[model samples]
Target: MLRLLYVMTLTVCCLPLIPGLGGVLLSAASYLPALGLNEPNLDGWHAMTSWPGSGTALQLSLFTGVTATLLAILMTFLILQRCWGTQGWNRIEKWLSPLLAMPHVAFAIGFALTFSPSGWLFRLFAALTGETEPYLWSLVQDSQGFGLILALAIKETPFLLLMSLSVLKQMQVDRLLTASRSLGYNASASWLKVVFPQWLTKMRFPIYAVLAYGMSVVDVAMILGPSSPSTFAVLVWQWFNDPDLTQVPRAAAGAIALFVACFGVLLLYRLAEYFLVKGWQSWQFSGSKTYSLPGKYLFGFVALLPVIIIPVLLVWSFALRWRFPSLWPTRTTTRFWEQEVGNLLELAANSLILGLVSASVALVFAIGCLEYRDKYHKSVPQLVIAIPMLIPQLSILFGIQIAIYMLPGQWHVPATIWAHILFAFPYVYLALDGPWHSFDQRLTQTARSLGHSAWKAWVSVKLPIVLPAILLAWAVGLSVSFAQYLPTQLLGAGRITTLTTEAVSLASGQDRRISAIYGLIQAFLPLVFFGIALAASRIADPQRRLARHADKQVSSNELISTKPNH
Candidate 1:
């Protein structure tokens, strides 16, 4: 049974990456036969390098992606240092789920509506100053990358916090704090010197995930990024959507470049974390507190912006007569909802089914893989799981599309669902990895010694023990599936539509009502999944209690059976 599970896990989670990578690699090198480019060439590479403003675009992408990712990490560390295991930490913990639940596209749209040139703030400025000259500003689509960086940073901070929570939990922050405090250090100083190094090490994976995500992000970048010299992922996305046949190879090359850039950034981040935190251990010993982070203020500001943004979006979605210089909507109607209701119903159904199916499948495979790893003392490589997580969606997706077309069937629902599964599996695997490794293995052995078969022991013991982690991984998978843009777009072949693509495409036209409806629905999917995860984790608390009760019963039964009267 265990061996079968091992094989099933391999088939479900790890094998698809071969075809995924192969398809992209072939197309990226211009060896695509379907497009009549049988002869491999460097033309695609040359085209990517020679494009107008390409260098500027790459620089802008780096600036926004790297800056936002690092800033979020720093903010996460500060928040943890000050608040972890403290009274204030509870409030932040409560907020983390909803913040993490908000979709990137939704957050980006709301951000623009709140801060852009024609946005609410500017209108307020016009009304207050009585200057109708309409001073020109284009911050929303500013040629520089400030808008993109700010939006990405805001969207990413919540994720970093959530990730930090997991790391902090594993680090035994309370014990470290107590130990350091006994050495005469201040509370903050104890955290900086003792807890941070361990936290940083555990945090490397999430940091890499963040960096890769920010660098490779397409939907968020499209909503808030500069237009004249767009980010690299956006540029690759445009190329993939280009109607011209000759541009496909260029798009493939761009995807390859994105993959490379993601890898390079992660490598650099690892080196930097090592140098600052690990190699220079002296800083932990000798340095005076030079860096005083405004952590509470940063959290307050970051948390406030999103709270304000959501209400503003709610107003825009209902407003019929909202225009410049108005503090509030002049007219309100459900007509926006009325107009979009039917389309949203269909899109919502599609999104729900996709998220559910993909998340469930990934969960099963993840559990199998982890169980197999425990029993056999072997496992899949970490990099295999992370490749899909780190790589940009647009880069490999076009090749996957071509591969789909080459398969003996037309694009269909199954293909789209499979694409989601492929993408969602990595997140599911990573989510399960920590808990699985940390699980107490002796419980399963004890169950087996009690005359339970291996399968029964696992079903009756291990599954119950890890059910919370399983559910959380499933939720993570669902969010990954819900936020999918490129895979659904390319694999669905435009016949199948999801909320993310709808939200992004409509956002291009600047119709806030229509876009808001889609954004709300997009945000709702993850919230629903997260809610389920939270509930399941709570409900599964019974398993632990039941196990303890059963163990007590077994001990009592044995004591009674061993009477001395015989």
Candidate 2:
């Protein structure tokens, strides 16, 4: 049974990559049978290279991608360093779910609405200046892609922090901190020297995921990124959308270039980690200064940024007449919501269906993979599982779509769902990885000793123990599916109208009111699941229930003792 499940997992999760990558690579080589170009050549490469601003676009991608990733990691580490055991950690933990649930496109929509030229900040300035409007530049579509960098940094920090939570939990962080303090180190110095290196090593994969995302994201980049010469990913996306069928090779080459560039960034990260943590031992001892960041404030801002963003989205959605130089809406109505209610409901249903199906399938496959590894003491490679995440979506989607076209009948819905699973599986698996590794095996053994079969033992003991993690991973998978943009766009071929697709489409119109409606819907869908996941995790956790029961008993004892004294 385990072997069958292991086989099923590999087939479901990893088999798609073969054809996906193969098709893209073949297309990149200019071997387009559909275009009647039978011969493989470098024409596509030449065309892509010779395109105006192509080089600059790649450079822009690299700059924004690398810088954003570094900023997110720095923010994550600083927050973990300063707030991990503090009161601020509580707030940070409380907000991580909502922050993580915010889709990139939704966040970008709110961000643009708040920070654009005639946006809220500008209105604040205009009110002070006693002007209805003024000529002012804003971060939206900044030529340097700085706005995209900032947005990505702020958006991805929550993911990094969440990943760190699993790692820190396994490390016995309190013990490490106590031991470091006894060894003549303050909290700041101890965190920097004693904990930083180890955390970075464990954190390298999540960092790679962030870096890849920063480089390859299209929806967020489209909403806030520069337009003159867009990021390389945007360029490739445009190429794929070009009407000319013969232009497919150029798009393929560009995807290959993106794939290579992303790999380069990952390599750079590995080298930097190696050298910083292992190559230089002196830094571990050289830092005696109590240099720490204001991470409490940083996390508060991180938490607060979304607070402002969500309300901004909600207010914009209903504002019948919201002009500049006004903090509050002058007029508001629900007619917009009323008008789009049916359509939005359809989109929401489609999106919810996709998210649930994909996440559930991915969750089952992830459990099988982890269980296989536990039973057999061998597993699929981590690199294999992470390929979908680490590679650019555009790099594989084009080829996958073509392969779909080759199939008979309408495969659009199935293809789209498969694409979601392909992408969502990695995140789901990684989410479960930490908990699966940390699980104590003795409980499972004890169950087996009671004459339970292997499957029964797992279900009776191990499953309940890790139910919280499983639920959280399922939420992560659902959010991942909800956030998917390009897959639905290319694969669904207009037959499927997800909230994400609608949100991005509405956002493209620059209609703040309508865009806000979709953005709020898109953002809210995942938050509902995340809220459920958090609540369920807490309620389902045996340890938490025990602790609550113990507290109740202790309070009862104290009351009884105090009554006699009184």
Candidate 3:
């Protein structure tokens, strides 16, 4: 039964990638039978290559993807070099959950609200300068992709920070720091020379994840990217969504081009990692030359951007006509809320059910995999788990959708939920990997010696101890599920109406008010789940303490009973 369960879990969780990849390749090559294109040809390839300034779009995509990912990595390390194992670390930990919980879509919307030319910043500038003219600078949709880079950098930094915390914890940073200090190295030098190499080596998966996201992110790019010749992924998406049937080949070609782009970038990352970190062994051994980074100020700026943005979103949510040059809303009303309340409720319910179900399912499977790893001393290689995360969602979802059709069932909510779980599992698994591996096995052994069954030992000894991580993983999964755009759209066939799908579709219509409302509500879903996860973690900690106290009390009572009455 155990073996069967393990096989079933692997099949369900990791086996879909083959078909997903195969389907996309076949379709992109013009072999999709469902679309009645049986003869494979280079027409798709021609379309991909011959489009006007297509090369520029692809170049822009690569530049934005790599630069944003590198910037985020730099920011993450800076924050850790300064704040790890300090008082600020605790505060960062507290905020990390909320920050991670905020979906990319939500972050992009809030970013636009603050940084767009006609946004809150411009209003402030107008008020201070007494100039009726709003700022003319095109910050939001600038042709240079600066806004996209900054937005992605800010959004992905928290993810890298979270991953770094786990890696640093497992590395035993204190011992390393002490040894480096004994060797006469300062804090910054110690980190760079003694700690960074090892940390970066272990962080390959998360870094790949960041790269994949930056390279292929569609929703965020749509909001903040250049419109004249949008990012490659967005251009491909437009091709796919084109109403013309003949354009399917063009879209498929674009998807193929995107796949190549992502693959090339991944190769570049690996080469860079090898050259900079591993190949240069001399760098680690070189004499220390202290480098000073303004990490505190960098973190302050990153934090302050979101802080300023949230109020803008809230104010916009209630504004009826808060036009240009108004420091505050010219008129405010609750009507947006009242108008959206009913539809928002329905969307919220759909989003909540999908997020809760998918995250819960993924958590169960993650626990199973972790337990199997612990007992068997064999692990699912990180690359296998990272494939879904590191591959562009648009690149593979079409293939997966075709595979779903090949299955013996009609597409419905269950299929959509399953796709969400498939995507969410890797994240949930990654989130739990740190805690699960770090758990001491001796406690389980002690429980077993005290006559607890294996299952009982897990529940009473293991589960309680790692329950905090489980909750956090659940939140991570929930956020991933909530933020899903392409998977739900492709798999759900427009029947499943999550906040993301609604938000994206509404944004296409370019109604700022409607889009803002949807964006705020989309942000709210994960916030609610993370809030519950946070409270649950705190309550679980207290309960474990109480249980420990009760165990001690019982032991004392037994000792008293054994002694004489005096």
Candidate 4:
């Protein structure tokens, strides 16, 4: 039964990658039989490449993606090196949940609200200087894509920090710092020389995820990215949405190009990582001098940026009439909320149903895969499982859409939910991996020894111990599903209306009130699940005292050993 379940899990979670990739490949080669283009040819690639501004679009993607990733990585390392063991670390960690809870779309909306020429910043400048002339330069939709890059960098920093948590915990950074400091190196010097290389190496996967996201992000890029040429991902999305049927192959080819570009960027990142850490070892040993980072201020800025963003969203949602140069909404009303309340409920329901169903299904598959690994001592490789994550969604989504088109039924909900599950499973699996691996098998053995069946032992003993992690994993999956825009938009065929899709669509209208309403709801849905997960984790953990004490001890050890004289 377990083996059968494992097979089923793989079918549900992993097998889709095959059809997804194949469909995209065939369509890219202009061999889609459904569209009456049975013969394989390079016309699709030729058309995609020959499209005006295609090169510029690709350049935009590369520039914004690489710049954002490098900036986020640099910020993450600086925060870790300077503040990991300090009291400020607690504050940073506390802020991580909320910062992470804000979806990319919501953050993009808020960022535009704060940074756009007519946004609050300009209003403040106008009010202070009495310069009523409208500003010409704009960060939102800037030609160079700097706004998009900044938004992606700021949004991804917290995620990189969150990803760093487990990596840092595993690195035993305190010991490294202690050992290095004993050799007459300052705390900053020790961290730079001793801890950075290993941390960077371990951070490869997270960095890949970040880079892929930056390159392939459509919704966020749409909100904040330049539209004249747009990023390649956005261009591919536009092509996919083209009403002309013949353009389908062009879209497919663009998707393939995007996948290749992202894959190339990932390799470049890996090579850069190797060169920085391994090829440049002289920097590690040649210097006792180390530069101090303003980590506290950086962290404070990153944390408080969201705090400011959320409130602006709220204010905009309620404002009925607000002119430029007004610091606060001059006259506020709930008219937008009143008008949207009915549709909001339905949108929320669709989002809720999809999120719950997909996340639950993904969680089950993840659990089954983890159990299979434990029982059989073999499992699918991590890279295989993470293919959905590391690959650009636009690439395979075209293929998945083609597969769905061949199915003989209404597939909007199922296809969307399936896509959500495909993407969500890897995160669920990763979230549960640590807890499942660290679980004490002795408890299950003891239960079995006491006349329990294998199933009974797992249900009664192992399940309870890991239930908190499981809940958190479910929440993570739920969040991933809720935040998804591309999968839902493409697979649902515009029949399924969710907060994310609505938010992205409304953003183009440039209605702050409407955009705020959708963005707030979009951001709120994930926080609901995250809150439940946090509460459940606290409720499920019986050894709160021990856990708290262990955390304290770890913090103390890190502080004592790695505390820098700043």
Reference-based TM-score of each model = 0.89, 0.95, 0.94, 0.92
User: lDDT, candidate 3, residue 486?
Assistant: 86
Which ranges of candidate 3 are over 4 A from the true structure? 405-409, 542-566
Q: Ranking under TM-score, best-scoring first?
A: 2, 3, 4, 1
At residue 65, what lDDT does model 3 achieve? 94
lDDT over C-alpha atoms for residue 408 of model 1: 88
Off by over 4 Å in 2: 129-131, 287-289, 547-566
Q: What lDDT tens digits, residue by residue, belong to model 4 across residues 491-518?
A: 8988998898999999989999999989
Best TM-score among the predictions, by candidate number: 2
Q: Is 1 or 2 the stronger prediction by lDDT?
A: 2
- The C-alpha lDDT values of all candidates are 0.80, 0.89, 0.84, 0.86
Clashing pairs in 3: none
Clash-forming residue pairs, model 4: none
Candidate 3 C-alpha lDDT tens digits along 1-566: 44554565677666767777887777778787777888998777788789897888898899999999999999988898898888988888887887788788877887887887788887888888887876778678789899999999988898898898779988999999999889888889888888888888889989999999898989988888888899999999888788875657777778778888898889988998899887878988786557665587577777777667666777888888887888788888888788888989898899989998999988888888788888888777776688788888888777777778778868667778877887898999989999987889999999999999999999988988899889989999999999998888888888888888888777667666677788888877788889988889877874778989999999999998999876
Candidate 1: residue 437 lDDT (0-100): 69
* Over 4 Å off, model 1: 12-14, 123-139, 289-292, 459-465, 543-566
Error of 1 at 235 (Å): 1.0
lDDT: which is higher, 1 or 3?
A: 3
